[model samples]
Target: MIEDIYEYADPRFRNLTLPNTQLERLYDGCRWAEGPVWFNDGGYLLWSDIPNQRILRWTPEQGVSVYRAASNFANGNTRDQQGRLVTCEHGTRRVTRTEPDGTITVLADAFDGKRLNSPNDVVVHRDGGVWFTDPTYGILSDYEGYQAEPEQAGRNVYRIDPHSGEVVCVADDFVQPNGLAFAPDGQTLYIADSARTHDPAAPHHIRAMEVVDGRWLGKSRVLAQIEPGIPDGLRVDVQGNIWTSAGDGIQCFDAQGTLLGKILLPEKVANLTFGGPRRNRLFITANTSLYLIHVAVAGAQYP
Candidate 1:
């Protein structure tokens, strides 16, 4: 008999349980949804609607509200070690940090005197440096932001040294690098290659690279090959499981690349973040609607 797709589970683990509850859609009617960041201090979740050029906030009481208009067509967002909001702006093609007082500080905008293509996703290192992926996806169309001429050669990942203010390319060879996340241990970096958008035959897979002496090394290995829809953004759980957004739902995979569980959703999930009072709530940006679910796992400490 053929294996049941929805009933399938990895053989290595068996505590999976499918929640009967449907995803609670918080708000809808967004042109395109991306970048989910959870702020525990404010008891709310924030995400970007790229085509709308706005960042939206959602709380249990207020439902949803506009956090900021003309958000530079922001893509991915995360909190730094100091709990400050770090964002990747497609319109500005730079990475910025939002201070506690609401001041915006540009972290990185150019490399070698040329503007970046578009900042995609970002993560902060323990040493205070910011790393992000720069791909041309945002500037290829007017849906997310105004189309602009390419300013860089190839899509690459860059690191901004907090102390020196120098931006360096850490990795360069990806066709269209998108979401990125460091493993809980900080020794591994996971990057989602959405290159299929440029090259139809290109494999859409999540690749893992080893970090050595502040540089990415070793052969890039395929962590997972997304089907139906490509992987956009993702986060790692405390237990080292990767929670990635796909067309079908949020897919979870073990550190060894074993598919563990999946949280099915009605719409295509763009990105997600773990937040809530206990940091166990998974806030998902599924197309226009935002959904939340309480999970047993906690988000990685550095995410």
Candidate 2:
């Protein structure tokens, strides 16, 4: 019966999902949920409730609890190489790191002497670099973050050096960069442009580019174009497969950017992450609820 939730575009996708496992609705009541990060050591998961301005924690032992209130409208979250939680705050328009002692460290907030437009999604490189996407969604209205004028000339993707603490712009040509992820080997970077969120004629595709010298990027090419919705957040598996959020549910693509399959849900999905002990549990954040399902493959990002 669980197999009924999936639509296979490619035969390979059938091997990625399990038939016995059923999709579970973990919880609901969130205004908007995003940014799921799993901690293996603690056996817990943390995600953002943007409109509610809180970060909710979930565990198999205990259902759900408020991890941090007044979270500054956190959007995307990931863990650095050091295992510290790295977060993108829409309200503060900055990227931050949560230390073991529970204190927050500001990693990046501005570039070229101007304040950043709002850091959306973030990812950490194995080499200790902090990368994030800066878009104007947080400043466009007061629902998620405060309504204000964007200070940056363009939405850009930035990388914060591990050793120098220097912030550098890596990509500058995007209508609205939302989610981003790195390949297993950290050689290729994938970014989702959700410009169609406002303008229907804008791009609605995920771009793939070469990561040069851990700082610079090569020419980008459209890896996959989405329809019926835009790509919001995405994650890559060990095989270099990409799983991204869509209007209907989740769209999966193989390394070559081929449509592998789809996980269908009743509500539109906002973001997703792979978790569980084996990193095979796909945790999804939809409009106002959270869902989970088991997968056959493990996520490239480990605990």
RMSD each, Å: 2.3, 1.4
User: Could you tell me how far off, in angstroms, the CA of residue 227 lies in candidate 2 after the best superposition?
Assistant: 1.5
Candidate 2 per-residue lDDT, tens place, 1-303, comes to: 135889888899988888678889998989999999999889999999999999999999899999999999999999988889999999999999999999999999999999999899999888898889999999999999999998899999999999999999999999999999999998899999999999999999999989998788997889999877999999999988999999979999987889999999888899999999999999999999999999999999732
Q: Give the candidate number with the greatest lDDT.
A: 2
lDDT value, residue 85 of candidate 2: 95
> Each model's C-alpha lDDT?
0.83, 0.93
The lDDT, on a scale of 0 to 1, for candidate 1 is 0.83
- Tell me the tens digit of each residue's lDDT in model 1 across 136-176: 98889887867998889889999888789899998888888
- Which ten-residue region of model 1 has the weakest summed lDDT? 1-10
